[model samples]
Target: MKLKSFLLICFSMFFVVSTVQAATTISISVNGTTVKTDVAPFIENGTTYVPLRSVEQIEGLSIKSWNNKTKTLIISDPSKSMTFRVNNQSQSDSPLIKNNRVMVPIRFIARNFSSDVAWNAYTKTVHVAKINDKEKANLKSEDITESRIAAINIPIISTLKELTAGESSAGYFQLMFPEGESKNFFTIQNGIINHYQVKENAAWLTWSGIIGGNKNTNTFWVTNTDISSEVGQRPTSKDRLFFYNISEHSGQSQHGYISTNGEKTILGSKDMNSLNDLYPIPEEELKH
Candidate 1:
């Protein structure tokens, strides 16, 4: 019995030590500059994961927004945008928090941001660098178009109809419209829009409209306000014009209902006390 007990104790100690050794700390460098993080990076399942905060240290990359309730993080570079959810089981490799710091897969970030990544096994280091001009030229035509689209600021509940019309390459866009008692959510991708209505707890196809504007102008036009439908069809009414004017001095975008006859009822105006500007809903909340 004494000999058996001694063997069991040794086996437990070995297993514990092996587990600790498997998650070895690794070094990370971005654009030839070494980045230091409060929570050290580690390798697991042949993939290197780094702290989320460490990624912000890279040039041209910053955290655009964070939703504490949903634990979602949005990161944007100059030409690209990426979204990640913390502890999202739906994703195979979701961002996780370790030592109170969020950790994400390094290779995933590099691929999304159009950066190059190399792993040095001998030194246990990961190097990330921006793609050179030659590499950028080799990228697919769709990629180039996406970079251009990313530069445009499309307001919520709007689509880039004028910019993306007739182009086969489409980017992901979110739209939210109000229904009878619930809100309808849609994601436009590759010229196809998928609808999800909150009140009915159902998803279906619906007709959508073009809500686009010129960047230099303060006013934009909205046609065919009715988006709720059971079948996919083009809207027949092109006369229903909803105009929005953004003031340059005040730097405020205001929405109002403008009839075809030229009568306008702006939000918060004395004529329309009940109308209010629609605020953007966080992506995390919309997804849920």
Candidate 2:
């Protein structure tokens, strides 16, 4: 009986240590290549903690929540966003920041957007990898355009129309790049314009715009599906035209809205995809 009790205690202790004090970023390997970041990640306590961002960025993905009702965080590249539960729940109050460190939920922080997570207790580490090719392909082909990080000659009018239509009125234009490319999208807004989704690798001559007599000017990277950090200060003609940005990983995008009103409110969040079908991609644009 004593031996059995000892084993139970040991097992319990291991679980606690493996999932405590939130996720911290540490060195990790992506596709057999090692990368590093300052983002906190999941580790075996004493073992090095690998940052999920490093893996996600290296893997060309991002992370977001499955829904508001659940505590799961969905890591996704352009191709897909897989769900994972954080062992611990986060508080509504903003995260505590000590010194230069910003604290976040462990489980949420450990998972990257658009990747699969496997926790190995024996090895005392968490493994992140691209989901199976079948799943990845399916996710990529579902919506939007695949975005490769490349310099795109985006015309101001084209970007303005796409942005105002997609974002200003609680809408978004789905985008993607070719497979196996890393890029970001950026935009500049002036007056009344709230935000823009610019591909990281895309280069435009002018991003500043005038909306309702307000001048909004800002640059951003649009290469991640989840842009939670960019949502704030609703841009209006009266109040500074806040320049919120959007981005996504490279893969099959659902080709729909990911946020509304400067907040990262994706299409799936408000059941927009379920209610009304996504807008049809125009025949001219569907040539791809």
Candidate 3:
């Protein structure tokens, strides 16, 4: 009886350990910048799973549609397309919807998009990097210079007003920084700010935080200060409107004022236009 009881205890411990490993939270980074997601990624049976919406942020990948009746999901890019069935019990690698978020295999999706995916066991993190074909060809040439590489990495600066001038008015705008290769895309809808970062030739949704408004004044404050590391710290008050400009709907320096905060304040600016534009976000992204 003593030996049997010891065996049972050992089995129970093994089961608990396995369960913990399966549910381990995983951090995802694209090109090096860590991305924030509404539903955290996790590992199960040695496969890392991320939110399906997160996959849409990757360059050259788009979620076309998902049919509930058939449980079929269609994802495509300019060059290739793929389909998957959700919660297919017969398929171990099938995508699953949990807590209203569609979770898909990261490796499978990454490979389909021609992006390199790496896993770090120590940190429990997944890194996805998009391969630039032009960069590879340029590297092989002897004419490549340090100055040219620097110029290639430089991000184009543009204001929201300019980018969305001809399009239908929405509470969305693209903001670019002149300081670094980081381009920030934002949508100020309702009272929330959905922030996205463009890096490694792909876009990642970095933050979705609340914006505080003052009823007495025309100014509003961004509640979350730690939005982007590349842009550095920004003041919460109206001291400087980093990417928003109220007067002309143009991009402003750190010394600009915030005249409009809610809905009407989707401001942006442009400088030294480059092809490395901000990745487009889905129209229904915030709706979910």
Candidate 4:
């Protein structure tokens, strides 16, 4: 009976592993009421997956896929609209199917619904909260330049720089690209900054340039700096520092360094990194 006993032990181990995977859940809400299901959402490589149809029906959002090669989910809400990868949270031009369930980035859903969403690591639950109409209107009315950095992903581990009044008058920030041939450019004129909004498959960040009072081209400058110099750069008479959020596509920089006539006098190095950092690479940007 030794063989029989060994078989029994192996079977028991398999059952235990299956039980753990099936234990994960997505707690959903309806009119302030929460509903928990015994059904376990699919999981792959640590990301919790949910059914697209189920999420759309309950959340009142419409999802449609146009390209046959790619499964796209579009939230037609006028207030906000964005597409997310079906399989990975990284940037994606298309979605994926895991165990027959359509996986997507939680942020895409949050942006569309004007809701704040976060993932609970221990519980593996995707939390979503809806924002009222009044809040939606207020956010829309805010100065676009004032809050442009809100939705963009910024690494939390970045350093902050301090700036002087002259520096603040002229917007001057530098961006670190992802080691590619891609180049970023912008212009500052008459206290106004104009630049392209850099975007990848799954995400995009702000790179808008600002103009100073004099409208001089020499007043705008950009550079890449080392983390060790972060502290030293912050105290300069015409320098500023800021820490960007982890989800930001590009890191943060201190801008608004201008002279009395709205001219750029100094261009310094400004970028820092943490020991352990996370940079989101949208998977969908690959197909495009």
Candidate 5:
């Protein structure tokens, strides 16, 4: 009995350490304005987790209880009239509650609801722009665009920004860059890239079954190089496909020439047979 109890305790401890990372205070901004919430936001597995419900904010979001504590969270947007399971049992990414507070996946919510989300790596803040927030987000970016980094341009597409820019701006996207021929490109063996909202927090999943291949996630945060000391391992800035200026608008991208690290494989919309087809970001959306 004692041996069984010890094994159970070990499993519990492993679960906690694997799923949870260092808690950092996050700055929440919606439509370019700071928002105060009843409960602050936190990060897990490199994704930004927000309270399932905000106080007098996000009027469009509404939810029902967790089915008598089965640990399943359901949310709906009557404004958008969409619903989905929080745990997404079939998927690796799942919403969780800590400290008696339930947290929803902000990135997942933004993607389905037509929203844009950006992060300020230096200040460690988050920017969320809903359908209405887009105009405000654009204006906010304009205000700081001169002082902050401008939207990066993709060398191959010339018309589009780096794929990473969309994720940086949208805050949640699963991007993939397959191995193509490029002397400068990084992360050679092309496969789908599972991006952790934050680059440094990805290593925690090395032992987990969920990770597809973060090695293709060649994007790195050059400005906050030391930010991962809390996570013990430093994120590699080498072999990243793109690097942008580390400004509030740029989400603390590395300040320098925009990286053409992995554009060797031309990205297209209609032709999935081309190089690798990751999720497509609207062309106009790249400007902001």
Candidate 6:
């Protein structure tokens, strides 16, 4: 990578804060359950520090490997492994042990596990979630199959538009999990989506095809601070789209949207137009 581009990436990966929130009511919630610990998480420099050991408490998540000599922690299952080495206490993203508690970047697990992470200021909560179809079996959503749109008094679109990988301004990714059984495509961009409309905004979008391995599904997921909608409800900022499956560790993020742009876009689940809605991930997002 070019020096300039690498510098930009490194800068974006970090954060800075003037006031440290040590006494804040920060806590960790996995799947949907709050992770209990005598040692509560705290915020420093705009990054949340969580008990590294609190990770193991999460049922489905386990330490696949821990090399004490190297101070390396590998939180993994059959699907994913996250590596984080203890850096010097002065380093920004370094892991630290406090009062017999192991602390690391709070967002480390969520980012690596394909789970969505959010930090809410109003309620002072940290949300981490690895959502899936099995958990949402009760709140299931159906496709826009011809019948639904017919009642809306609108003409249906005959065909969806084609998507080309590497063509997106924001990079694209192939999120693979569910033990090699699912491959979801996400083309991320700093814009929101509206059904049958072409308006771009500042919020970022994580567009995908067939969320949770659902066949022929179009999901226009948002990753920002606005709480656009309520859970399992119509468009709002509070929604999130989890793409992987889980059985043992069902820890999800605290309920809130984290953003730098102060914008909220409604997450997609139900179809917008019978034919015209947000496009799906391009076929090229898949690995060869």
Pairing residues by index, what is the TM-score of model 5? 0.35
lDDT of candidate 5 at residue 151, scale 0 to 100: 13
C-alpha RMSD between model 6 and the true structure? 18.7
Return whichever of 1 and 5 wins on TM-score: 1
lDDT, candidate 6, 210-269, per-residue tens? 222121122333422232221222232332232211111122111111232323222323
Q: Could you give candidate 3's per-residue lDDT for residues 10-34 as a string of tens digits?
A: 1232233344346557777665545
Error of 2 at 47 (Å): 14
- The estimated TM-scores of all candidates read 0.37, 0.23, 0.42, 0.31, 0.35, 0.40
Can you give the lDDT of residue 183 in candidate 1? Answer: 31
Please list the residue runs of candidate 3 whose C-alpha ends up more than 4 Å from where it truly belongs after superposition: 1-24, 88-92, 142-288
Q: How many clashes in each candidate? A: 0, 55, 8, 40, 4, 22
Report the C-alpha lDDT of model 5 over 35-152, residue by residue, as the tens digit: 7777888776678877766512443556644654577755656554443445533232466657777677776665566555555453455656443333334324433232111111
Best by TM-score: 3
Instruction: Give the Cα-based TM-score of candidate 1 against the true structure.
Output: 0.37
Candidate 4's TM-score reads 0.31
Provide the RMSD of all predictions against the true structure, rounded to 1 decimal.
23.4, 20.1, 19.6, 20.3, 18.1, 18.7
How does model 2 fare in lDDT? 0.30
Which residue runs of candidate 5 sit more than 4 Å off their true CA positions?
1-24, 64-66, 79-93, 133-288
Order the candidates by TM-score, highest first: 3, 6, 1, 5, 4, 2
Best by lDDT: 3
lDDT of 2 by residue, 177-266 (tens): 222221223322212222322322212212222332121122122222222223223322211111112212221223222222323222
